[model samples]
Target: MNKAIVVTGTPATGKTTVAKAIANKLNLKYIDVNSLIRTHNLSEGYDDKMKCDIVDTDKLNRILKQMIKDSDQKLVIDSHLSHHLPKSYVELCIVTKCELKELKQRLEKRGYSKAKVRENLDAEIFDICRNEAKEKGHNVIVINTSEGSKDIDDVLEEFGFLKQFEA
Candidate 1:
């Protein structure tokens, strides 16, 4: 069976970067669900004035299922709502984390407002993504990304993706 790895975390936690690195190293297809949502204009009122709300779970799951079915190789799926998707399709679920102050600084540098940064920090501290993974019965791996980009590679190695045959 083709494996699917779900990389999820609070905003600015380097989920996208990690997902891309893992995909490249493993020769897996990288699918950023957030980019899919944006490219297809699936969400309502996703304009500059509106902060992006979570997409409908059913719709998101449907899209993800279709993507998985269409792919011929393993997939690295990155999204904030990966837990909401079907657990049976996911082989591994990783939640990227970072120090609150560092996360705030990164988000601020990305032009996020104080309120948005605070919300994300709270979510990370409370282990929202980890909780969701637990509830979904996913094998969860939590990685802290505050130090630098190398942490992502370390995570992939820990998950055995860096090995040629393990992936």
Candidate 2:
């Protein structure tokens, strides 16, 4: 798992939880893409309507590539935007998904405005992240992360990550 891995999907699909768990299990560095955006000033602007940052994807990719080259430590990058990264820089890309009903409830619980909730829900239903990762030529895996399901670990193990990291 020395190569970079991306955990991405709809906004409320539990990317952070699954990514962090993988990072912890494999002793990889967990890279929070949101924090990286803020820290590196990779913001294109603030999306007032969506209440989200408009990231400069090109710049984000460049910086992330450099970060990967600068360290030997494995990285688990977390963000819905992470799938946009070039495939050459990523070894595995995991997309978290949840049932639309559960996904909607999760998004609503996050206190997002109706429009924002609808937007994220649509992204999930349409499998936006998964499609984009495939288009980017990434080796992608999808996991159902509906509420009370922690099957992410099983998915990782099936992908050979757990065994690869066993010491």
Candidate 3:
């Protein structure tokens, strides 16, 4: 894995889970964007209505690029904001998706306000992450976790990462 991969999608769609799994399987570094924001102070402020921090994209992109350059390891960037990074920095962009019914349940389980749930659901329905990744000119892969984790293994194999284990 010589290139960085980004796992991005609507919140609670298993972006972090799938990203970490890919990192572990492929021996890539898992870079949590949220943690990076906290450490680098890239947040402009909290969005109380959304219950999330508003990260400064320009600063975050600089830090992430530097981090990628500084490390020898291939990275799996785990964030919805990850796709906003320039396509040159990413080799593959993965968007996790779930069936709508299950997605709604998952959102509700997070105890988000009804409005938040609806907002996130709408984002998913509209394919925000997938569309953005395409617009950014990334090699995009969409995984429906509601289907199975088998697709993850296929992705790793297709990308030539599984060969290291065989070696």
Measured against the true structure, the TM-scores of the candidates, in listed sequence, are 0.87, 0.91, 0.89
Query: With candidate 3 superimposed using the best TM-score fit, by how many Å does residue 5's alpha carbon deviate from the native?
Result: 0.6
Best by TM-score: 2
lDDT score at residue 87, model 3, on the 0-100 scale: 85
lDDT pick, better of 1 and 2: 2
CA lDDT scores, all candidates in order:
0.79, 0.85, 0.83
| Model 3 Cα lDDT, one tens digit per residue, 54-86 | 888888888888877777788889999999888
Ordered by TM-score, highest first, the candidates read: 2, 3, 1
Ranking by lDDT: 2, 3, 1
Model 3 CA deviation exceeding 4 Å by range: 149-167
- The 10 consecutive residues of candidate 2 with the worst lDDT sum are 158-167
Tens digit of lDDT per residue, candidate 2, span 29-108? 89999999888988888998899998878888888888888877878899898889888889889899899998888888
What is the C-alpha lDDT profile of model 1 across 43-67, one tens digit per residue? 8654343266547768888888877
RMSD of 2: 2.1
What's the C-alpha lDDT at position 52 in model 2? 95
Backbone clashes for every candidate come to 0, 0, 0
